[model samples]
Target: MNVINKLKETAVSVFPVMVIVLLLGLTVVPLDKYLLIRFVFGGILLILGLTIFLVGIDLGIQPMGERCGAELTRKRSLSLLLICAFVIGFIVTAAEPDIQVFGSQVRGLFSFVNKNVFTFVIAAGVGIFITIGLLRTVLNISIKWVLFILYAILFGVMIFCPQSFIGIAFDSGGATTGPMTVPFIMALGLGVSSVRSDDENSFGLTGICSIGPIMAVLLYSLYLKSQGNFDSSSVVQISETAEAVAAGSPLSQIFGPFEEISGEVLRDSVISIMPLFGLFILFQAFLLKMTARQVAKIVIGFIYSFIGLTVFLIGVHGGFSQVGSELGFALGSKALSNGGIWFVLLIAVGLVFGAVIVCAEPAVWVLSEQVESVSGGTITRKLLLVFLAIGTAIAICLALIRSVAGFDLKWILIPGYGLSMLLMIFCPSMFSGIAFDSGGVASGPLTSTFVLSFTLGAACVGANGNDSFGVIALVAMMPLIAIQIMGIMFKLKQKKGGQK
Candidate 1:
């Protein structure tokens, strides 16, 4: 699709969020003028960035990933394909903007760990899991069994890890599967799976790869604990503060957020694309040599992607996060004032916020559109979006509950994933993969930044520091069940039609 068309689509996704926040500010949680202005500008930036990013994915990243996957499969050398898969997965994930945000957050919380080292650990996990996913497709193994075994291992590791790390590990998994990584990885999966004449295997690689980070983080946490290096008291307090815009012309107030974030956003945007750019060049030279014209088109796409991603992150950080946090704090304080009776308000608002926010997630758009395309319209994008939104809403409610109640992460995640695994028995195979993949995509950059910041804001009201950490984790988990349930119904419908 053209950029204009993508812009309109993104506008529809983003404006609801702006409207909701505006209404909340006017009625229940009044935000100051400066913050609201920034939010409006942020929405505009989000629309523009998401539009350009989608176009770039179509023109550049998806094609390259698919071609690389297809070419590797055709080579008929398992060893080479596995090695390349690991390298691609590792580098691409390391460059993912979402992972960087997550790593930095963890680093900010615990100054003892270096952000680079933490990100490296997360990237290594992705690389190893990508290899396993590719191998599963090649060996024609059932994703259900693979998922079962992987989650079993995840839970086993979760037992010994510290409370602080549990949420971070799951959030890390979700973060790795963000805008930068989802399109390319999903395309790569399609490319590899296309080698087989079946559709079932095409949808699960992202799902499988998401598992890697969770495992890796959990193991790292366990190791930290074993060495007695973890100092729980050293963790920094999580809170949000909206600084005043610089005193100057009116234009300064309008442009404050953009100006504040430009430098870091530019640097991250460059870092985010470089690894993938280098990998694409390697593939072009070795595996999929194309004409000069094709090369130029891909290069143009990369440029678009870089610019789009930079603008998107700036918009999110500049506009959405502070507002979300402010609103959450307002609501949380109100809830507290009423002797905690206002917890219901948290659930209701969280549901609405979660529903709309997931739609704005760039990766959600990518995954939904890709699902429809890959399934030849059998599984509609609207269907995927609806299910994802529902799942995300439930997840937000759960996060808010934890924020107020201060429950253990195990109580929610363990049972939630257990149910997800059980649902796979009744779900169609393709849907199983799609559902798992949806979990990752549902909790993209917007969830990590906006939704998560909102949850943290509420948690801070009660001094529930650790409660907010797993919002992304819950956001990632719900889709596994939602999509699987949808898949079961779809399967039943097919059976009924056959009987008729």
Candidate 2:
């Protein structure tokens, strides 16, 4: 029954994307039959995989993270807490499927980047910042000051990094906070905050953690720039790869990627979970005195999480990505051939895609539920979802505009982030934290994968050589502004009610 309920919910979240794609094929896009079939198959897998994954998160990941957090913090050793937090953040991030997916894309596009090095650098960034976030929570520092200082430094560093690296760096921030990282990290934050009896602080850990990767990648990009003599000739345009995939593979070749990816995903999933499992065991032995039954349940939960994660990765990588690429190429081609109406059509499609695809993101649901729970239902899940969808929809529109117009990303990003930081002044502090965290959560696995692939394809064809790296960055950013706006509204409503 629980599994069935989860399936129904997951289906609702996922089916809109499938419906939109089918509609596109029937009308404007006209996808290849085989590619469309693969997309449908992948959607089925996505619904199923996401159902199981959510169940596993509830059963194992959240509980375990909360327990570990609370117990670790109870020890009252700041040094120990910071060290453990860093390790947890690093291990979870290193194992994150989203980062792995992003890293693979990066490596494919740029010959100079080593996937392992990139992943490691990103993981280190999350680790360092997770430590900083915890320190802020423990010390009760202001989130606004912390955010202002970090981003100011980020912008300073951004000026020094290569323009190409900027988009990838910002996208890295979003990708690091995917399904594998968000639940555990949010739960862990909740647990830590519980120890301090402070609910507001629970919301900002992921926000702070998101900043780490952008800074780290920017700094790493500077290092790469310093090296100077790399071959630029080997760079593979994302559109080329998307075009190849969009062109359609043989019937035999279609499932072949699935077969190959399943094995690889299974391996990666195990590796991803092991460090956390090992940490749990270490705590179990020394700190987390659990009964045999409790331990058994958690062990089973880990197994479910591992299996679900593997399946989810396969569904995403092998299935939906091709369709996204294909759709983008088709749209891009249309815009090239037929200008005015096609551009409007593309923006409309982007709005719908941005709004719906976010629904399918597991981390978005987790964060929404957290917001509702933490606010004691003052902020309903449905309300937050609406805000997120609107924010995401707007983000996609901007991305489409950028791709179509060939503007520098800084034009959108500088104002977007500036508005977010500025809004922190009037927005309730709790909402400020929630808003920043939502910014991270809103850009999860699907944004990094499908939405990103789509943008790359569009940029390849539509913009005549404009870079396609910043869509995810924009997707990650818009929610900060949106949610903070919601916060200000909520405050005004409260004031109105008091006056009445």
Candidate 3:
């Protein structure tokens, strides 16, 4: 029954993309038969892989996070809690599939930035911010004030940071809170807040944690810019074609990219996941000391997580990446050639794509579920999903406009964030946290892998690589406003209900 439910959920999530792709293939962009076959096969794998991966998260990762968080808070040792938060934050983020994929894309663009170093810096940023988030909860600090102060610091720092690095820095924040990190961090937040008497504190830890990577990356970008050891060149290249083999095996042709990407993904997954697993075991021995049954369940959950994530990565890299880039390239080139009608068509496609793609993000489901549960059914999943879809659609429209107009990202971000911060002042306290966190949640693996590739393809039409980098940041940003608007509506409704 559980397996069937998971399959149903995966299918619902994946259906929109499949429909969109088919529509494009039949209409504007006729994909090569071979590529189309690969894409279809990849989509199948994505459904299966995501189903298994989400199940594993429910069984293993979420439980581990909650247990560890509750245990840590029970210890009542501030130093120990901080250390554990930092370690968990760093390890989980370093192991995040979204972060790994985004890092590879960044490295492909700018070979000068060492991939390992870049990934570690982002992970360190997550770790530090998570530690701060934990402290905020323990200290009973207001999330709105913390966010206001942090954004003030962030925007101030942005003045000194290089323009080229700004988009990538904000994108890092969204990418960090993906499938691997969201369930755990959110569970941890819930667990930690369980110790508190107030319900409000339960919700904001993830929101605060999301801010860390942006600040960290911006600071690092400043350091890199200062050193004067970076490349600003923008190259527009498509996916590499695999060599034809005379053996002519059909299976070999289908699985060629899978074989290539699987090995690297497997190696990276092990290296990334093992440390966190090992740390959990140590914590169990020294701190948690659960029974044999509990230990065994978690261990099994870890195995499932590993298998699920591996399959998911294979599907994404082998199936989605090439097709997305190809579609974007075709659409972008067409729009460039036929300006008036084609441009309008591109915007329409982007808006629809943005709305549909958010539905497919695994972390988005987790977030919506959390919000609905935390709000005691006052905020329905359907409502939140609608708002998120609308927000993402607007974001995509803005990204397309920016790509076509060749505007600086600051023109959008400065005002976008400024309005969000102002909204925070007016929104209910809980909504402020949820709104900010939704920004990170809405821009998950799907946006990073597919929508981002799509935007980059568009940017390459007549723009630099840096132009598209901000698209994900925009996708991440708009949700802050949309959700906060929902919050305002909720507050008004509550007041009206009180008068009755």
Candidate 4:
């Protein structure tokens, strides 16, 4: 029954993307037979793998995170809470596939940013911020004030960080809060808040925690920039021929690419999960010991999570990467050659594509469900989806425009975030938290894989791919304003009801 429901959910998420690709193939961009076949196969794997992965999260990871959070809070020791928070945040983020993907892409473009070092810096940021978030909940600090101060510091740091690092830094905040991190971190937040009688305190930890990576990456970038050690070349070239690699036999073609990725993903997953598992065991042994049956169930859950993650990563790398890159390249190259009308059409397609793709993000579903539950259905999943979709569409349109026109990312990010922060003054506190968190949630695996590839393709043709790095950052930023507008409407409605 659980599997059946998850399958249905996954289908709903993936179907629109398949339809969009088919439309593009028929109308604007016709794919070669090999690329088309790979896409179809990849889409199938995405649905299957995502369904299994989400189920595993529910059965295993979420429960364990909640228990860990609950047990840590139960101890009533500040030092223990901070240490555990840092450790858990770092470990969970280090294993995140989105972060890994983003790091690889950046390394491929700029050889100076070592992938391992980059990932570790982002992980450390999440860890420290998570510690701060936990402290806020325990001490009853206002999320709004915390966010205002942190973002102020973030913008100040941005002045020193190189232009190349700015977009990547903000994008890291979104990417790290992906499938593995969101459910567990959110569940952990709930567990910490559960101890508090106040419902208001139940929300905002994830929102605050999301800020950590942005600041962490920005600070690291500033440090690197200060050392004057890296190349400042803006003329990076993407190979068109790279997208046309020959396909193998049908079976081998479908399964071949996964061979190397499977081993790497499996190793990363094991390394990412074992520490948390070991920590849980230690905590159970010494602090909040559970019954034997409870331990057995959680252990089984961990196994399911590990298997699901391995399969999911294989599907993403094997099925999605090449096709996404190729499609973007094809569309982008065409748009560049055929100017005027074709440029407008390309932008329109980008907007529609962005709108639809958000529905397919697995993390978006988790977030929408949690929001509805927390808001007592005042913010329905459908309503939240609309706001997110619209925001994503706008963000993608801007990204496409920027790729074509060669605008500085700071121009968009500065005013866009300024408006978002301004909205917080008028927005409800809970809505403010959800809005900021949604910015991160909306840019999950699908954005990293498909939308980003599409943007890079456009960047390759329209400009040097230097501008492409910021597309995901734009996807992450726009939702804050869109959702906050919705929050204002909700507040108005509530006030009207009160007056009545």
Name the candidate that leads on TM-score. 1
lDDT of 4 by residue, 286-383 (tens): 87688888888777777776776666666766667676667776777777887888788778878988898898787787778778877788789989
Q: Report the C-alpha displacement of residue 440, candidate 4, in angstroms.
A: 1.7
Q: How much lDDT does each candidate structure score?
A: 0.86, 0.84, 0.80, 0.79
Q: Sort the candidates on lDDT, descending order.
A: 1, 2, 3, 4
* Residue 455's lDDT in candidate 4: 76
For 1-500, candidate 3 gives per-residue lDDT tens digits of: 28798788779878778888877887778876566677788888888887877777777777788788888999999899999899889988888767877788777766667788889999999999899888988898998899899889999999998787788898888888877778788888877887775567777676677778888888888787777755545433434322323244677767777887889978866865687688778888898888899888888877877787778767877878777777776787888888888888878888988998887777787778777887788889889998899999999989987876688889999999999999988899888878877888888777777787777777668555344577888998999999999999989998999999
- Identify the runs in model 4 with alpha carbons over 4 angstroms from their true place: 231-242, 258-260
lDDT of 2 at 9: 77
Clashes of 1: 0
Tens-digit lDDT string for candidate 1 (96-189): 7778777878888877777888999999999999999999999999999999999998898888888888989998889898787888899998
Query: Which 10 consecutive positions of candidate 2 have the poorest summed lDDT?
Result: 239-248
Error of 3 at 129 (Å): 0.6
The candidate scoring highest on lDDT is 1
* Clashing residue pairs found in predicted model 4: none
Badly placed stretches (over 4 Å) of model 1 are 239-249, 339-341
The total number of steric clashes, by the backbone 3 Å criterion, in model 3 comes to 0
